[model samples]
Target: MVDIKSWIFKDCCLVFSLLCISIVGITTGDQEVLTNSWLVELSEGGEAAARDIAKRAGFSYVSPVLGSDTEFHFIHNAVPKTRFRRSILHTRKLKSHPFVKRAVQQTGFVRSKRGYKPLKGVLLSDLHINNPEIGQLINDEKDVVIGKDPTDPLFDKEWFLKNRGQSGGIKGLDLNVEAAWGMGFTGKGVTTAIMDDGIDYLHEDLKYNYNSEASYDFSSNDHFPYPRYTDTWFNSHGTRCAGEIAAARDNDVCGVGVAYDSKVAGLRMLDQPFMTDLIEANAMGHMPNIIDIYSASWGPTDDGKTVDGPRNLTMRAIVKGVNEGRNGKGNIYVWASGDGGQEDDCNCDGYAASMWTISINSATNDGQTAGYDESCSSTLASTFSNGKSTIRDAGVATTDLYNNCTTTHSGTSAAAPEAAGIFALALEANRNLTWRDMQHLTVLTSKRNRLFDPYLKHFWQYNGAGLEFNHLFGYGVLDAGAMVYMANHWKPLPERFHCTAGSIKKEMNFGTNEPITLTIDTDACKGTDNEVNFLEHLQAFVTVKSSYRGNIVMHLTSPMNTTSMILSQRPNDDEHKNGFTRWPFMTTHTWAEAPRGTWTLRVENIAGKNNEYDDGLFREWTLVLHGTRDPPYHHQDADEENQTKLFKVKRMHDMAMKN
Candidate 1:
């Protein structure tokens, strides 16, 4: 045996050295000092020359940035702390060096977990009691269990896994993982890394499946990623997430994990004073070959006012993971769409909006959108989370910190791990599945089932491909049984391609009531090597100037006439100074649609009664389509035919519902 864990650790240490750097440019108690760390980018084939230059400049070369070959970190311990001017001069010298391509002093940014409030509306003080509908549903079929039930005491309360109307939930409204488990696909050989605060590897339910070799603490520069102790147990977030993925089955401790036989690794990068570019890069790119999935429930603040995403180094890391990780099959990155509720829009969040990640939202046990679920076109799917009513208080059940178990793992944080676990099972069913393949399986196998937005804030509609999607639920809640069944016979998609179909350079002005409409007609790069006939992901890179940015609402209509709400009004976003600049508003709503006709973009100012500003201008925009030249379902086998049948059935059901 190769001892995969040890191999992964050695590989990580070979090219990644720990840097004892301090926060740069941050003020501590009215004193501001520049740190010694510098992000240095070297010219191609100039490593030796760059090292020589660093030595001459009295700077020690650290390791290469986790995913890049030419970019590196350098430090000067002799003058560890310096004034801003001195640091700037040093940066200028490095950039001016012949071998250096770029150099900048490292700065820190804030990254918050998706669900900061674990018990947003389900606190004990707010709990409802003695309600008729709050009691658990009795299982009538005692002898015909679908899968071997785990003896874990809390398993029954884990309604997301196997809901039998538990806690006033609708029966059968769950992930449907039991049938897949009965088929023996328990994510046996897969490993999922929780990129969060930290994980309690010593927890009884998690210790058996913990892969310590692949675990690391970027916050404290250690191998053990044990979360820091706190009285409020706030740091238990990662552990709770891990338990959702790989907690041992029938352990008499907590509820069984979604992929009970799978392994879990902890990447403790979030329990730090500030998040650095290097730290984010290292965590995402760590042990890519060994870790199959990276489940992140954190992102830029969910406050509807902020619009941010991955910085440069982190962006490079994600691209590298998708292009070169897992022997070129690509690493699966699962993200939690923001929890900003109706006031926020997830398109403003760059991480969830990125095409590379599968953004998951949250649903209640009764198949309704959670109160905190942020609506976005980029959300790929949804999973179960906390749902409180006068009837019952239902939340996720999983392991907690210090050998404890929690029945209230709420938020998108709790929802993402379930998706990760389901993906792990699919990976085990077919190890050759790529990141894109996983996404295809999600779109194909996920079922609308009984999920809906109870408030009707978002409605389910079939796109051009007859695949149903919702801004809140995406394709729908994940169906683990369907996913694994399809994965067993899935074929790898053809090589992916991208084409810039068209661009608009001139600015067009529009008033609050008038809508700005633009069109692009192309063959989707036909007759070229980068031809993209079938659309998988579309990006409308846009630049706009608005007096009040919050009033801006944008929509993209594909050549197939499937309209996508790419951008929506954010009540909290009043930023007018720097309107959107080349922000890629992406959507998977046009999946498998032909991209060879006129595509339309409609920009509206939903200012309505509160028009705080006068007018807006559409500066410039570009339409980029990504897909394969050939039909991705070239091998139209029985699985594909069967899935199409399911779609037809769903379409009929949708029509009846509308009627």
Candidate 2:
């Protein structure tokens, strides 16, 4: 009988595991449920009414489930159920029903009113389709063909100096190579992987920066990574993006790049101007290499819902890389937020909405007067470029696929690579840092004040302080120097502590004056000396019998040493005032002042209702904690050696796990 019981338990465990796996697969799909519209609950007397309404609306499907007394679950198609015209009518009619409670539009799939239109002649044509027109415009005009003389006032000498003269800046632009180099983000030894259309690996300006050993043409599974010059058509979008990210610097040749010292890994997944899911999938499969950053300047149109279709497989693969790929040492995934800000809401959801990806928005040059010039009240400008003179922020000078130096381009696609280049600098600063830590630090330390434009109030509404994280600017504009400061001192926050009396649903009896020790364990604490100040990163509160009146004591034990006893009384009156200080809970204190290691927190109910406590009298209380560490300054000096060692260790651990 005992053996039979054991077998039953084991079978139950297996079933539970399978169920969990299935749920994960569903929730993490590329087409995730974005809105709660498809969820509905039936009332006792309204069951028939709800079904009739759904059927009349042409939902084609429905499922029933129990919920709150006033709410219930009526599952239907996860996507919008009503036709465009019907949806308008439904909204107007639903507003009249008192018992209907509420009706919302579901968002599980993207709804596109029109299909994708490929770029004519540009991406689909052979050879240079615009060559004749360009030739006619610049016939023997050396200044127009190349640029104004080196002494031209309009020439960007600052840009030239900053890019170390490798880029073709306006003749007199002063380049600040010293300032850029002083920041320690030369992009040396970093590998940036570009997942887009094929690039011209042979382009003179970009050829020196290409990591030929690391480059791949996933679109055709061939050795050629250049755009095919068939007939009169050629698409060099990918090549242009690559050049902007890491084109060779100080070569005294063409255009400059953000990270001139970085190596470029061109991974072609788009053919000419078209995107293919199959090719993306194939490219994703080969991405588990030593890549420091993955830059993708493409995304579906943000249409208020998640995109679905077979192409979703590629997104899933990308997420896998974010969560568990590269042997758990997460890789940074950078994506262009989108270029649909003109008519569509900038916040529309898409691949960039994924928590695993860092979404990049665009900004025009400090001088450009036209284009989508939304104020940067919220997010940071990761990079700058001349708008529309070249291709994709065209004014930003960089190597062209055809080796021609041009400047008319503008789009979020161009902006993302600029951000990716800055990230490469941060990575170069400290390679031991995880991608999450890098992202959080970058956002936290961005130049919020510099990007704010007080002239635009509408764009500043969502911005937290007319400084950081605005709806338009995101964290204000990106600051390479500030990012460097943060990288040198960034740290991860402490994980939240789960304080429960075993099961939340199960009732527990604690008689009045009966001292019960409620133990708390934080899942994120590493219990290592390096993480000793983990507790300093969190804030917590406790309550007994629904009243937040209690005394909490914390004790820590570790291989290094034991912590001194500490106590916190309930009802802390001190409001969180200091920018760097954690808020004091009525009954909470930080661990920063305490010793690090394995720790236990005990909450004692000092006073509350029911002197003779009953099991039903107990209620749950919420605890909130926030913690992070700044990267150490010494890391900057020891970046190369420490980074190499850490990378090897991580690689070995990953290999062992796979074995």
Candidate 3:
């Protein structure tokens, strides 16, 4: 057999070397040099000539492989060879010039190109008061059983019934289900997709509420949603995550979910080598319908570095979904920030670090304490196991796949899904809200006073306010109650207004009842594709009209197309169906207020369709209406100036207009 250990060590060395080079280059200002930086091959024939030109240009690093290309990072400072000389000694003919990639421009860090590591471990007994070993660890003398045991005499078949309470089970833990229910979120009609190892659908606590219709097995392309029999160690990690989000309660069982009534759908993608990409593609294929909130507990190493390769494809797909997929009826993508602390050797924070998605960090049971058991010195506990288990006092508790009720586990991984469950509740409470609306409300509603200290010392200082939205706690442990309040009442941001036409030669008649237009001569719309055309125009001149007294709000309701219409009826079905077929249409008439507020008009494309579709099919239009105030204005803004600034930002919106 091949030496797996040696191979891993070699890969580590490669990563270390690249990291060192990047660090050294950045620290020494040598990053400005072309030779010392990462290089990308533009053309084959230009290899020798490019090298000579680069050498003459004082460039250091050069690579022919596109995967190894670093040209994207330094594109801002890169001097095009054509701008310089033409002779053999001073100039070089080009096959392909090093073009900068978009990621580098956006993030400044080079993406890692590493593969996935399959989880390997066994299922242990639930670590509760009943387990002597666990009881001793936490110094508990009382006997407490959090879940049911298959071998126990009290185990009954009727207990396995859907939505039934656990009669023979211990009165273990309460996941604050009543609070969630009171917030108007029962998770009814909502689906949560779990991307992790295969789930034991037969587990008593999970079986009742398990969604047989939504579960999918990406491990072997089989229709069976459960894990393969050969994988003897199929633990309860996925199952526990499911329970944390939607486990039924009230029948005297151990625990309950934040959204107990929500449906749990499993998508197993963590098993086998290089399965991450496959899982991501499968989830992306589902788009806006199959799943609403994607709860992911597993992530890269805790070292806080990114990796590249096919896995990037999945990241790209997720970003695509966040930006344009689901017809702008965006789905919430939740990722566990990782349990590793600053001292962990592997700097492996995965998709969480990406700005495209929301990263969830753990908090202890009090809903206020630290969720993971950090070392005395603030490092990740060395004994932390990635195996299937549960930890109760740490604020997280769940069932084990082995059917033994003797074990409990703790980790940021567990805490992440707990938050995801709360998000499910928020979604259920307010099904009319979009993904962005939900996320902003959650972050804004989170208490800044409850901020958790990060393992990396720098995060606290680098992140302002030391409260809301630190890289460590990520809006400080999601507040389900607060989120629900905002979800049910919050409104969408107003569409910003700008005059794309150089000057309105005609006194724009924006209707007497509409909001007035403040014309400014800034090139805000210049060079932008945000222009409306009667036919085939890249840009257009338009007016935004708003009514501040009616229930019709100018909510950008669809991601696929842009149009304007009047809502003459309540609960209109056309509101959901009028948008592009690929995206969910924003329900515009649901606002509490009728036509009254500031509205904006600009030129942009309807992006709800897939990239493969013809761009010509999308058309732009003018917008006129009124609606509710921006939801996050009061919470997210530090003051009135900040609120005004947010209001002034005019995005080239191509939202499907509501009728």
Maximum-TM-score candidate? 1
Clashing residue pair totals per candidate (backbone < 3 A)? 0, 77, 50
Please give the ranking of all candidate structures by TM-score, highest first, separated by commas. 1, 2, 3
Instruction: Give the TM-score (vs. native) of candidate 2.
Output: 0.50
**Residue 542 accuracy (lDDT) in model 3:** 26
> Which of 1 and 3 is ahead in TM-score?
1
- Candidate with better lDDT, 2 vs 3: 2
lDDT per residue for candidate 1 within 269-309, as digits (tens), equals 99865566778888999989998999999987777777777
lDDT score, candidate 3: 0.38
Against the hidden reference, what TM-scores do the models get? 0.85, 0.50, 0.48
How are the candidates ranked when ordered by lDDT, highest leading?
A: 1, 2, 3
- Name model 3 segments beyond 4 Å from true: 1-177, 228-234, 303-312, 323-327, 344-350, 366-395, 402-407, 449-451, 454-469, 495-659
Model 3 clashing-pair count: 50
Give candidate 1's TM-score: 0.85
Q: List model 2 lDDT by residue over 399-432, tens digit each.
A: 5556654443346666777788777777786666
How far out, in Å, is residue 165 in model 1?
Answer: 0.4
